[model samples]
Target: MEYRKFGDTIVLRLEVGEEIAESLAALCEKEKLELCQVSGLGAAGQITVGVFDTEKKEYFSREYQGDFEIGSLTGNITRKEGKPYLHLHLVFGNPRQNVCVAGHLNRAVISATAELFVRVLPGSVGRRMDDEVGLNLFQFSQDS
Candidate 1:
C-alpha cells in the first residue's frame, strides 16, 4: 500500500493481493488516526460481507469468490479502548454485471488496485458496547 497525506486527508492505493480491512487498520495505526471517514473503490478477487440481524443480534455473512468491481466502500474509524477500530460497508458488482451485493464488510482481497481516501475528523470518538443493541455505538463528548 502507498499513500500521501494532504492536510487532514489521505489518499491511498492498495496493491493487488492486499486485504482491504487489514490495510486500513495498518494505516490507521501507522498514522495514529483516531477518528476518520473512509471511502474507496477497487476490484477484488475474494470478499466476505455480513448483514446484521438486529433481532438476533448477530451477523449472517456470505463469501464471494471470483472477480468483482467495487462500486462503493464507506465507513469510519474510531477508538475502542484507545486502539483504532474500523466499521465499514461495501457494495460490489459481479463480473457478469448482473448482480451487486451490499453489506457490512468482512474481508476483501484486492485483485487489481484500490483507490482510497480518508478524511480525519477533529476531536476523538470512542465506542461502547450497547447491551440493548448488541453492538458498539459511537460515544461523543457532551459538547458534541
Candidate 2:
C-alpha cells in the first residue's frame, strides 16, 4: 500500500492483495490519526459484512466470494480505548447483473485497486459497549 499525505487528508492507494480495512487501520495508526472520515470505491473478490441484530444482541455477518463492485464505503474513524475504531457501511454491486447487497463492512480483499479519501480531524470520540444494543458507539469528546 502506498499513500500520500496532503495536509489534513491522505490519499490511499491499495495494491493487489491488500485488504481494505486492514490496510486502512495500519495507515491510521502509522499516521497517528485520532479522528477521521473515510470513503472509497473499489473492487473485491471476497468480503464479509455485518448486520446488527438488536434483539439477539449480536452481529449477524454475511460473507460473499467472487468479484463485486464496492458501491459506497463511508465511515468515521476514531481512537477508542487506545485503538483505532472504524465504523463503516458498504454496498456491493455483484458481478452478475441485477444483484446488489449492502451492510456494515467487515473484511474485503482488494481485487485490483482501491482509491480512498481520508480526512484527518483533530478531536476524540470515546466508545463503550452498549449492552442492550451490543455495539461500540461513539460518545463525542470535545478535547482534542
Candidate 3:
C-alpha cells in the first residue's frame, strides 16, 4: 500500500494480494490518523461481508471467491484508546448484472487494484469499550 496526501485528502493505492481492512488499519496507525472518513472502489478476488444481527449482536457473514466489482466502500479511521480502529462497509456486484451484495466489510483481497480517498477530519473521535454491547463505539468529545 502506498499513499500521498493531496491537500486535505489522501490518495491511496492498494496493490493486488493485499487485504483491504488490515492494510487500512496499519496505514492509519502508521500515519497517526486520529479521525478520518474513507471511501473508494476496487475489485476483489476474495471477500467476506456480513450483516449485523442487532438482536443477537453477532454478524452473519458471506464469503465470495471470484471476481467482483466493488461498488462502494465507506467507513472511518479513528483511534480507540490510542490504538488504530478501522470500520468499513462494502458493496459488491457479482457476475450477473444488478446482482449485488453489501454489508459490513469483514475481509477482502484486492484482485487488481483499489483506489482510496480519505479526508482527514479536524477533530478527534476516540472510542472506548461499551460494556452493554461488548464492542467499541464512537465516543464524542463530551464523553471523554
Best by lDDT: 1
Mind giving the per-residue lDDT tens digits that candidate 1 earns over 23-120? 99999899989899999999999999999899999999999999999999999999888788899999998868699999999999999999999999
lDDT of 2 at 40: 94
Top of the candidates by TM-score: 1
C-alpha displacement of 90 in model 2, angstroms? Answer: 0.7
Where is model 2 poorest over a 10-residue stretch in terms of lDDT?
135-144
Each model's C-alpha lDDT? 0.94, 0.86, 0.88
Q: Mind giving the per-residue lDDT tens digits that candidate 3 earns over 1-144?
A: 999998889999999999999888888777778789999999999999998776787789989998899999999988776777888999998767668999999999999999999999887888887767856788887543
Error of 2 at 68 (Å): 0.7
Candidate 3 stretches with Cα past 4 Å from truth are 131-135, 142-144
Span of ten consecutive residues with least summed lDDT in model 3? 135-144
Q: All candidates' TM-scores?
A: 0.95, 0.93, 0.90
Q: What is the lDDT, from 0 to 100, of the residue 25 in candidate 1?
A: 94
Error of 2 at 112 (Å): 0.7
Q: Least accurate stretch of 10 residues (summed lDDT) in model 1?
A: 135-144
If the candidates were sorted by their TM-score against the true structure, best first, what order would they fall in? 1, 2, 3
List residue ranges in candidate 1 displaced over 4 A: 95-97, 141-144
CA RMSD (A), model 2: 1.7
